[model samples]
Target: MTFDVKKEEKQFYSAKGPELIKIPSMDFMAIRGTGNPNDEGGAYQRAVQTLYAVAYTIRMSEKAGISLPGYEPYVVSPLEGLWWQDGYAGVDLNKKSDFQWWSMIRLPRFASHEILDWAKNTAAEKKKIDTSDIQWFTYDEGLVVQAMHHGPYATEPETVSEMNDFVSDHELKEDFSTRYHHEVYLSDPRKIAPEKMKTILRHPVKK
Candidate 1:
């Protein structure tokens, strides 16, 4: 049955706002996006291309009536993504000279195997490369708290700080079992304008 995953009711925590609580360790497929440092335009375009490429593949597969176990797509990014940390997440922004940007699509842990199979093949075909261009992994099952950021990413620290406080108040500690701080992009400030930008910041938390 077709349903709106975005609208799907999920356990949530709200203090300053409603924080969507997603279980960690959901399997996901991602592209290691890199972009031109100076060519913000090119970087953005490429980022959009990569995001749509995978999203379309999943959507088309579902439309064609393909079924498998576990299914959902999340556009994952970093927590302090806008900052440049030299050899770290900052490297992607360095690619701007080459017209590249870093981004990725995170498939839900419950995403169907058939959907993943199709996504792999589809990415290879569209990007003119094989699996090398894509990286697939899984997120472990745990507590993840998320909320939408509606301003420039530079201003996200405040929002994240509040979210952290909320987690702490609720007796939740940061879950550091994983190496990555998960973020899902719901809006592209480069194109959508910051006033309307929406970024979902998710942190692994221990309840």
Candidate 2:
């Protein structure tokens, strides 16, 4: 059976309250790009396309006789992103056109180094697009305070303030070195209304 990380890894996806979760190290297929996501065919849009090109290549590796141990056909995880700008702890939503972001999709443990390389090469060959910027990233988010934000992405500051209040209440300070700010998009923006979009907001912290 296909191992669905979101369904099996319960703690990673479900959060209705401002709760703290300890997450271990996980590898990701990541690409760093700058500028507004709404820009017409800009870096932000291309980064996402590259991410999926490599992601689907790896997902369909079996067709190429590339078999992996303990592997089963499974759905790809939801799109996730790490947000921040140089020398800034928080991003200015109003200035999204100038925002910098590291867009990534979490790679399962079964996806090995060799498999990732194969996917990169395959994507380049089949799609005839540059996949050089994509790299394997190891992230160890030891302890984080997270909350479920139910609304539009444009109105996320209110939730961030709430998370900050929760963090201070527990005597924990934000750890900027580990990560700037993290978000897991649960709803498809194309299909879901902005008011109904679900995003998991996470902040790295130290006690």
Candidate 3:
């Protein structure tokens, strides 16, 4: 059976409305960059491309006779990102040029630094793109308020406002001291209609 995070971890990935939850530490293949994500062929787009390259390489390692202990067939996790801006409190969609982001994909438990190194080398050779900036690390998001956002990315502020209201109603404050504004892309923009897109928006919060 292929393990799917969306199905196995529904609470984390499928929130329909603003709600509070705790996120545990998890491993990821990440690449950091700055600038507008909407820019064609930009740093953010390249970062995403590099992330998937290495992620798929590790996922298919067994077929290449590379096996790791406790490895199992699993679905590649959705694309997730951590976003922030310098000297800004919360994300400002209008100021995309000032955005700093960590585009990443969750890795399975069996993934290790050795496997990641191998994957990066293989992907770099096969794709003919630099993968030197990729990183493997664990992140603990802790307490957060998250909701499933509908519609296009430009309309995210509407959902964000609702989440902020929920946080205040619950006496929790948005905290970006350690964590970041997180997003989980559940629907591929290419296949899904913009008005029907689904994105999990998460904000770190503290009581």
Candidate 4:
């Protein structure tokens, strides 16, 4: 059976309403870019492509005769992002051009720095795109409040507002000092209607 993070770790991916939870440290294959995500063939789009290329390379390593110690077959985690802007408290949906994003996909436990380097080189060779900027890093997102947002990306502010209310009710404060506003894409916009799309909106919080 294939290991699926969504099913295995339901709490992290599936949120019906705003709730507080603790997240542990996890490894990620990440790429950073600044620009409007809607720009055609732009930096954000290219960064996403690079991330997938490397992720798939690591996923299919066994088929390619690449050895990974203690490897297990699993489904790729959903695309996640850390979004923010300089001198801004939270994201401004209207001003996407000034957005700084860290687009990332979670890696399995077996993935290591050495394996990531190999995957980057192999993906670059296969996809004919520069993957040198892709970086391997670990993130520890401690306490957070998250909810499943239902609707288009542009409408996330509504959900964010609700989350903030919950935060205040619980006597917690949003701490963007060492963390960020995070999002996990659970549905592909290409296949799902904007009104029906699902996204997990998360923000770091502290008491």
Candidate 5:
């Protein structure tokens, strides 16, 4: 099912702090890129490709009776981002026309690293259409602040601004190296209107 990039925000949980939270992410894989994303067509294309690959992994895992923590089986798209410039926390669209640096990581919940490694390799094999090189991570603990983003991507600035405010009001500091922009998509773009699509944007901040 194709998910709409814009629309309504779905139900999700997020918090701020230096505490470890239990997140049961379903089985999925991620592809990482480290250059300007827009400049590198391969990066963007592969990012999208990985999504399908991991989605299928979730289906296969369920069929095999493998249960994951926070095992919603739904696609979770959390981005590891860097904001060198002041105020903004995402891709610099204007300068990103050719060489945008970015990476896409997939989160899957499991009891041990053994299954996690297997899942990553399995997803890569299934999605052989794209580059097989990717990374696997078990983000067991970190400070995360998330919120539901309503409306279009163009209007995401407001949501981001609010998130920043929350961080400030709560006396949270940002850890640049570990800072990331996490997103979970629930609406199928092919089936929902742009204004009605929802996306959850989560950013990591130090408490």
Candidate 6:
């Protein structure tokens, strides 16, 4: 069976409402960019394409026999982002222009730093795009509260408000120093209706 992380890991998806989960360590191939994600011709859009290009190159590495140890066929994980800004208490949906995002793809456990380097070079050569900016990141978000947000991106505030209320009721404090507003995109907006799009929004917290 092909290893599908989304199907195998329950926490990789979302719940109907707010739920707290202890996240484990995970590696990623990350790229940083600043600009509005909605800009059709912006850095954010280009960065996302670059991420996927590299991810797919790495995923298909086995065919080249230039692969990582313990490599197995697995579905590519969803796109995830760490959203924040210079001095914002939280991500301001209204201010996409100033958004500082760490856009990333969760790497399989078998993928290592060297494997990623090879993938970056391979993708750059094949795709004829700059891949020098892509970096390796290992993150463990620890404890966080997450929920499914089903709506257009602009309507995320409503879901965020609910997440905040749930956090307060559970007596948890935001840990901005260690964590930031994070999101896992489960729906492709271009293919899904605005009201039906799904995003798993999560925030790290401390007791």
Query: After superposition on all CA atoms, what RMSD does each candidate show versus the true structure?
Result: 6.2, 1.7, 1.0, 1.0, 7.0, 1.3
Per-residue lDDT tens digits of candidate 3, residues 119-206?
8999999889899999986789999999999999999999999999999899999999888999999999989899999999999999
Candidate 5's displacement at residue 13, Å, is 4.3
Give the lDDT of residue 11 in candidate 6. Answer: 66
Question: What lDDT does model 1 reach?
Answer: 0.53
Alpha-carbon shift of residue 37 in model 1 (angstroms): 8.8
Model 2, residue 164: C-alpha shift (Å): 1.2
Off by over 4 Å in 3: none
For all predicted structures, in order, the TM-scores are: 0.60, 0.92, 0.97, 0.97, 0.59, 0.95
lDDT of 5 by residue, 83-153 (tens): 23335554343444333333444443332455555665777676565434544544432556677777665
Question: What's the residue-level lDDT of 88 in candidate 5?
Answer: 56
> 4 or 6: which has the higher TM-score?
4
* Pairs of colliding residues, candidate 3: none
* TM-score of model 5 (CA atoms): 0.59
Q: What is the C-alpha lDDT profile of model 1 across 59-153, one tens digit per residue?
A: 56645576544544332322122222334421222233432223555455356656666776877686764454545555463566667777775
Cα lDDT tens digits, model 4, 1-207, are 789999999989899999999999988999988999999999988898899899999899999887888789989999999999999987777899999999999998678888899889998888898999999868999999999999999999999999999999999999998898999999999899999999999999999
Q: Is candidate 3 or candidate 5 better by lDDT?
A: 3
The Cα error of candidate 1 at residue 174, in Å, is: 2.3
lDDT of 3: 0.91
- Give residue 184's lDDT in candidate 1 (0 to 100): 58
Per model, state how many residue pairs clash. Answer: 27, 0, 0, 0, 21, 0
Whole-model lDDT per candidate: 0.53, 0.85, 0.91, 0.92, 0.52, 0.87
**Candidate 2 vs candidate 5, lDDT winner:** 2
- In model 3, what is the error at residue 190, expressed in angstroms? 1.0
- Model 6: colliding residue pairs: none
